[model samples]
Target chain A: MLVSYQTLRARPADAQRQAIRLGEYQSHTAGLGKGCLQANVVITPAAYALDFMRFCQRNPKPCPLIGVSDTGNPDMFTLGADIDIRTDIPAYNIYRYGELADTVPDIRAIWNDDLVAFALGCSFTFEHALLEAGIDVWHISNNSTVPMYRTSIFTVPAGPFRGGSVVSMRMIPSERVDEAVAISSRFPLAHGSPVHIGDPAAIDIADLSRPDWGDPVPMPVTHTPVFWACGVTPQAIIRNAKLPICITHKPGTMLLTEVPDDADVPLFQKS
Target chain B: MLVSYQTLRARPADAQRQAIRLGEYQSHTAGLGKGCLQANVVITPAAYALDFMRFCQRNPKPCPLIGVSDTGNPDMFTLGADIDIRTDIPAYNIYRYGELADTVPDIRAIWNDDLVAFALGCSFTFEHALLEAGIDVWHISNNSTVPMYRTSIFTVPAGPFRGGSVVSMRMIPSERVDEAVAISSRFPLAHGSPVHIGDPAAIDIADLSRPDWGDPVPMPVTHTPVFWACGVTPQAIIRNAKLPICITHKPGTMLLTEVPDDADVPLFQKS
Candidate 1:
């Protein structure tokens, strides 16, 4: 059932967290956080904030920065009225030396003043735009994660970060490709437009059936595989960098911010 | 006489010291720097580089970043094969603590490693795109600087930086506004699209006739003033920050880089 705009708007950031906080709704926030902007979270020591911020800036397609918390501060007011970085997210992925250490619902116990939390715009925000445009998102239809892949296209390197671009694949029907691109392009804060269309091999993906992460959806004969720069990229990259302590939202889990879906940032509305 | 491409190509960055480097040919480089991308330059201490870079990222349309040299490094290889930040720009404006100190042809003597240079994509790059689409940039026709203004839009604050957006205005026939927007949006690396289309006061400009900078051109009865985020924004922002040391190119002067005018950066080519 589709939620009414009034219903969605009535749910505050804290109210949306109630179900998750009480363990009644710890699942993915795909549809529950309706109309509010969701984000890919990354918390790292201030020593790495500069480089990581640069990395995000350099590769905005995969890491569209929406907000940055003050050093060691858990609040992300820029993203919302009172976003608590420590406990607002439904789940957190702890990484040590670029490897996943554990998955937890919150990081209150580990939160520190040296840590700066970055809220990067996520595709979930744009998926709403797509759905509104009456475009079918394969993963949404299948009730599964979007198939993602490691591509040969390397992102512009910054400091110790160097890796091939990672893309999330969506099978949009041929006629809808233009519409999909047009709508997604409006949300530059959320990856913004397809990186590759038609032949996947051109970008170095050997097989469409075998994605690097998440499940692959069968491509319909009428559909074309539209690839978008994925938010998962930074997790893969910072992991490879082997930072001593880094925290990110676990895949499928995200940090919901108070930024309205209609946030008037021109960059988000480009084209 | 126009310098032949063959002669300009063989000339090395180190050998090209002034406007005469292009074989005594100095005609505003409007079409002369073909293939060689030109950039707006801003130099500041490392302490301010991060904030300025953040400011640029936040205000991309007005200050789209192309490259940032490593702290104290004069040779920004990413922008050009051997371009020196200190002398590549044909002219420079030295500002000290929020005031213009001098307009100099070169700053080699004052160059230091503690200083960082930022290369921002210029509207000149996207003007090529607009021209290709058959849009007339009025200033180009009249051979005058594009009219600019300080608007009511305030940029997001970072550290000591805060100021209204500085926009360059263009008059386009009402019928061509869509084409102008579609063509320019392809060059997000430059100022992507018109920030405002119809009314001047919509963005806080009281009178279009009296522009804050550049010569104002009359809008034909059938034309509309299409405003675009201008590269002069960073210069205005850095000036407002009142940093002890800041360097920027003169209004018409810019740093020429090796990024081909036709360089296939996917972001600029999309759509």
Candidate 2:
């Protein structure tokens, strides 16, 4: 039984819905759990918690924190009432010494006592908002991963976490640029406003179609490629830091949180 | 010799002017370092450093961080070319276990190896911008310390630091309120825009006059009392945390830095 973006968004947080997702129901989470906030998951040892948190704090635009789990605790109650971190996600990406180790469905066996899970805000929330406002999310329109690029903008260094920003690309028609920015600004938890609206090379992305990660979906004829801070920043930082072991959800395989659609997530508020 | 705000603003290094301020020159900081950003100062021991930093990060509106001193170094070179934290401000407030102990010009002799100084953005920069844009700063017109109030807004708790938010008040005529917000929004490092406007009690502030601290300037008949997150929040948090020893500048006395008025602050950057 395959689910669609519209179906997932409409019935996000149906445990049966999510349980089915875990019961050999593997699929990308682009539109799952509609009205429910989906988060990008990153798990690392406690040794890097402080620095990683500082990194997120310093570079909020790219990595807005939604919930941080206590050390060794896999129950992310704050993000989702019944979230069992070990088996909630459909898939996980294991990285060892900055290299891809393996992709697994459930990380229950690998969960450690020193691991801290961070559920960061993802672009799906804002992309939903954009579409609701009649703006086109380039990747979604073409059924692909939003093109992501490494930018020249330097991020504030924190302990072992330091790297340039990673941005996701979206295309907005010229006339609706202001509306795109305005609507997105309301969802700061989701990448906030566009980081760059016009030029691709200006932010150091040499090629538009060639992205560092994720499938690149090109822009339409009448649309401008608008770049936004992406949730992939922490993954990049963790990779660059070369931690002994780190785990993340495969791109597009997000953790569906129980946070309601109209959840009060003010820019700095504890939502 | 006295330095005029206009003349001091034109000077290349504000730390030098601040060094002069330590030498018996007592004057308000407005206009003094026109392009240079000035900040509210709070100095404390390392025991409370992490909590305080967390407090600021959790409640950024009133506590936008500009620079922090290396324990007892007193040299905030990152903020200015030659900032001497120990004697940069014209005035200082010494608090002993949450009680006001003494007010002094400098703490060079009492400086210890465990002290950490924090420089937070003040509302002066944004207020200056508002005034320049033809928006009347009611408190400035009344020659007062922009009315501040202790609101019911609870700051996200961090260790021993927890307290209600303190907001500085300004009365913006309804017509120019949007423009005032726009001008102030650009200076997030300097408290950003108003946290609340129109009513005082809505945020738990009981009285217009008789502020917990600072002067209480009255609002105009047709103007809305716009409130901004204030720098004094950290001071209040430190006081409640009840650290054995803490030091901060007097309400109006601040540490002037060389950061240009337009220098980009890292916290607000999208990428």
> Top model by DockQ, which number?
1
| lDDT tens digits, residue span A1-271, model 1 | 2333334435765776664554344445665577767888888887777678767766788888777766777877666655688777767889999989998877888998789888888888889988888887877666667888888877877777779878988889899899999998877778887788889999999999998877879888999999999888888898678999999987666777766766644222212
Candidate 1 has a TM-score of: 0.79
lDDT per residue for candidate 2 within A1-271, as digits (tens), equals: 5555545545535753465446454556776666767788888897776557656665677877676766788977666557888888877889998888999888988999989888788888887888888776766766667777889878877667788888888778988889988987876667778778888888888998888877877567788888888888777877789999999888777888777655543222234
Q: Rate the local accuracy (lDDT) of all candidates.
A: 0.75, 0.74
Question: Model 2 chain B, poorest ten-residue lDDT window?
Answer: B262-271
Model 1 spans with C-alpha error above 4 angstroms: A1-24, A32-37, A70-73, A129-136, A171-187, A193-212, A215-226, A258-271, B1-38, B75-83, B129-135, B172-187, B196-212, B216-226, B257-271
Residue pairs in steric clash, candidate 2? A8-A33, A8-A34, A9-A34, A12-A33, B5-B32, B9-B34
Mind giving the per-residue lDDT tens digits that candidate 2 earns over B1-271?
Answer: 6555445545655444654555644445554455567798888886676557656655677887677766668876557767787788867888888888898878897888888788888888777788788887765665455666788877777668788888888777878888888888888778887788788889988888778877777666888778888888866777788888888877766677777666644332222
lDDT of 1: 0.75
True contacts kept of each: 0.04, 0.04
Clashes, model 2: 6
Best prediction by TM-score: 1
Tell me the interface RMSD of model 1, in angstroms. 3.3
